[model samples]
Target: MVELRRDPVVERWITIPRERAASIEGLFPGKQEVSRGACPFCPTAMHEREIYSIKDDQGRWSVLVVPDLRPILEMEGTLERRAKGIYDGMSGVGAHEIVIETREHNQSWATMAADQLGLVLRAYRDRSSQLRGDKRFRAIFMAKNYGGMASRFSHPHSHVLALPIVPRTLVEEVQGSEDYFQYKERCVWCDVKEQELAKSERTVALTDRFLVHTPYASRYPFELNVMPFRHVADFASSTDEEIADLGGCLRTTFEIVKNRLHDPSYSMIIHSVPLRNASEHSYHWHIEIRPQLTSLAGFEWGTGFFTNPIPPEVAAQHLRG
Candidate 1:
């Protein structure tokens, strides 16, 4: 069984699943192809085990969710917390599923239609909400890696991981937001959004319900964040209309980035309040897009500070143009 081990100093939980190492070699053997090659995600090559799927009016799947063939954390296991000589650990009992964005292998997030992307987002929300019912899971993370360097597979897909313990980064984010609220009595993200809108400097695009902007303190060049105009802590609680607006906002944001950067590789991550937490008014959910342009050096690894060459203001101006 997979185990979640904690770093005593950092207070971070790490999943140690030795079983996945054997399947890693066979996961992505070569270039994935829709018609000519052996790509498991392709409709023709897809496995029969589908967890859930969203179908079009024509009765064809637009978005689908399936169990990961080689999951980092297994779904069926008891989350038994134990200690070993002052070290705390628990069984890695969580859900790992893949969100197949499209039936066509060539269809990508940047190129897909806004409506199609909305369906994909809906699938994410549905899966996350469903998985939250399991009392064993504490947090769910949704992430998509969109390049050869960042992704293990070439298929247009995202991963949803239901973790037994909240990640340290997310824990810090929640704490920081909570602390800020205690002092200011306002949501920090809401204030940031209002300030960005008022300045009209770092703002990329804005929909009726969403705002896309390059954060003032972006760690990477062209790092964009998509936030809701109205503060919402849980992404799964987003209404249909809000999700549709978000789809349009994301589509426009990606279009501008891809056109300017020549299809740069990036990673998109959804940040939401933990499932175990009460409805938090201080925390606002957002999607962060970090383009992988430069390599991380030793200095960056040693120090948590990132040395960005391009400023967010300049990046925003370029994206707007």
Candidate 2:
């Protein structure tokens, strides 16, 4: 049966196609061969200066944070808002940093040690907290693009962007959340966690502090959402214990995907509160993992809707097994 699902926190619809024709190999292509070239992310071949790093027992860097080699936005400029004929724009003033996830170039979240992943997650928290100090930045985005086609480089790294304005998608999400809170008087994500837990149909796994589940309106096959049980608005404020548990939770989730889908290319995004403002009561921080199983056809772009061959319930069942 074909189904159309609307996202709870966003006014977006996802259509589940009638035919489940995408096979495992079709969804996850074969692993690409790596080049034996000079990787700048490697410690010995590094060209950029480090902003922050965590050391291992041997005094070697475990996780490193460096400025993006080619930044999308400039870091030194102040926000300059401008208006043209019936249009508005701003200067490209923002901070873009690379969180070099692991010292080892070949390691990934699925393969890396749990403690090492914790260090990586901690680096994200530290960098976000540091960037929040800059009054010029209104929002911070944290994400990881993994596998050959998804990432620019083969190195295990993620990105952090501190923007002068909140992104449109995030703005909509916060607004939707606030509207829900105004009516229901509770956080939407908290309610989702509770409902998903109660149903267990879309839940893949659960830790003491986090829930790993496929959203009811998942846009892609094997899409995953990892949310903390605690209603925290900013990921930067995550406690040590919470981060540690989250590390294990993420590691297990990615490993499951890796094993089930043959290490597909995927993008992972962390959604949190804007830097300048607060949404503690209405919003909650969460992580979204979208495996690049299928490309967006013209229909999706033209209609602003996504088509998924696998229903989230079926995807969750496959993932759980």
Candidate 3:
């Protein structure tokens, strides 16, 4: 049997292909281990392009933020908007960097110490806050791709992008939240958090400062949303104590997913208010972790619809270790 679920906040529809639920394990394409020569992120191969870092007691860097080895945008240019006969283009002028989460070559979020993870979060906030000074940038996006096709290397690192223009998907989300606020005079995310916390059906784990849960209309199996109770629009504003709590919350979420799903590849994205719109109250910041258990076929790409083999409630139950 198949069922359609609609996300109340974004109004996005998800199809639950329950008939394939029994064969959910078959959908996960095992991540192939790649044999690589030298890891550039290691201390020996590291360069001096350090943007930000946190050091240990011995003066060694624990978390390092450096420019991306293969950056999509260059920071050495002025914002130049160009137009052709019918299309518009702009100079690829922005900042792209990599946040090395740890000094250990094989450390992962599931096994990393919570305090170490907190340092990683601090690096993210520090770099993002510094990049926000550039008025030319409209959005600062931070994301992590673990294993599978989503990542090129096996090392645990995340990307930071300072984009000149806001991505369309984020723009839509902000607009949707704003629309909901205009209608109900409340933040959509806050309402969702309240409802999920009250129900506890889809809630996997909750910390004092953060809530980790499965979305009612989850886009993928084992997908989880991590939200802070504080209605802050900017991730950069997260305090030290909040970051410490969130580190534990994230570690628990990823460890559960890793142990239950056999360590499937995943993508995690931080969706915060745009750089200029840091004070927007309508949009609440959150992080989305989507494990790549299934591939997207023609139906998904053509119709903008996602099919989940397992229900979010069941997934939450399995994940609530």
Per-residue lDDT for 28-117 in model 3, tens only?
656344537998788877568888889999998898889986576767778776556544556767888999898788989999999899
- Model 1 lDDT, residue 94, Cα: 93
lDDT of 1 by residue, 1-321 (tens): 688899988879998874544445445747442234577787877567889999989998888899998788999978899899889999889999999898888867778899988998999899989998999988888899887768767778999999989999889899999999999999999999889889989999999998899999998999999998888898998999998888888888888888988888899999999987963888999999998988887888899789999999999999998
- Lowest-lDDT window of 10 residues in candidate 1? 29-38
Clashing pairs in 2: none
- lDDT to native, each model: 0.87, 0.85, 0.84
Residue lDDT tens for model 2, 1-321: 222334445544333433443355544545444455788788887546889999888998888898986676668766666556544556667788998888788888999998899999999999999999999898888989998768768889999988777766888889999999999999999999999999999999899999999999988888899999999899999999999999999989999999998899999999999876757789899999999999889999898798899999999999888
Rank list by lDDT: 1, 2, 3
Lowest lDDT sum, 10 consecutive residues, model 2, at 13-22
Model 3 CA lDDT for position 236 = 86
- What shift in Å separates residue 30 of candidate 2 from its native position after superposition? 17
Ordered list by TM-score, greatest first? 1, 3, 2
Q: For candidate 1, report its TM-score.
A: 0.93
User: In each prediction, how many residue pairs overlap at the backbone (N, C-alpha, C within less than 3 A)?
Assistant: 0, 0, 0
